[model samples]
Target: MASTRQIITDLRAQARALDGRHLSGSMMDGVCRSLRRGADELDRLLGELAMLRAFAEIPGDAE
Candidate 1:
């Protein structure tokens, strides 16, 4: 299981739960959107970092 996928899934679940709550106000909605955006950025950065690390594993200048 990719942790990035898990993180996204968890966040989506939490957002859904918040939507179901009686106090699901605009503030909470905005916060959730911001959190999702941040998570997305982190996920993108992680993918790039993974690729960079993988490339670094190659010996010499072939990488």
Candidate 2:
């Protein structure tokens, strides 16, 4: 299975390919925007997960 980061990379590539083609007000334009937003969301999710992992790795007072 592909990792989240890898998926985001592919998504960004696809988005870039669809971008800036003067397809304003068209379905392809909408698709490109949606793909970009999806990638942005996934990136944020990865950051949140990494932050949680870092917190988990820290030494706790109870430990």
Candidate 3:
């Protein structure tokens, strides 16, 4: 699976590319909205990943 950071980066790039090119009602508008949602989701996932890693490193933590 792709790392959360990388997934966010890809979504940001897609959003940038779609910026300023969509009309009021077009497919690109939907694409842009989806990309924004994807980026937000990835950010949340990254936070979860960090918490998991920190929990794993607790002293006396089990495998």
Who wins the TM-score comparison?
2
User: Lowest summed-lDDT stretch of 10 residues in model 2?
Assistant: 54-63
Predicted candidate 3 versus true structure: per-residue lDDT over 1-63, tens digit per residue: 775677788998998899768566664867888898999987987677668878777542222
TM-score-based ranking: 2, 3, 1
Q: Scored by CA lDDT, what does every candidate get?
A: 0.67, 0.79, 0.76
RMSD of each: 6.0, 6.3, 4.9
State the lDDT of candidate 1 residue by residue for 14-62, as single tens digits: 7766653456344567657766787788778877767777787743323
Candidate 2 residue-wise lDDT, 1-63, digit = tens: 788888999998998898766565555777788888999999999887777767888533221
TM-score of each: 0.57, 0.74, 0.66
Cα displacement (angstroms), candidate 3, residue 19, comes to 1.9
Distance from true location, Cα of 9 in model 3, Å: 1.0
The TM-score of predicted model 2 comes to: 0.74
Candidate 1: where is the Cα deviation over 4 Å?
Answer: 1-5, 20-27, 58-63
A best-first ranking of the candidates according to their lDDT comes to 2, 3, 1
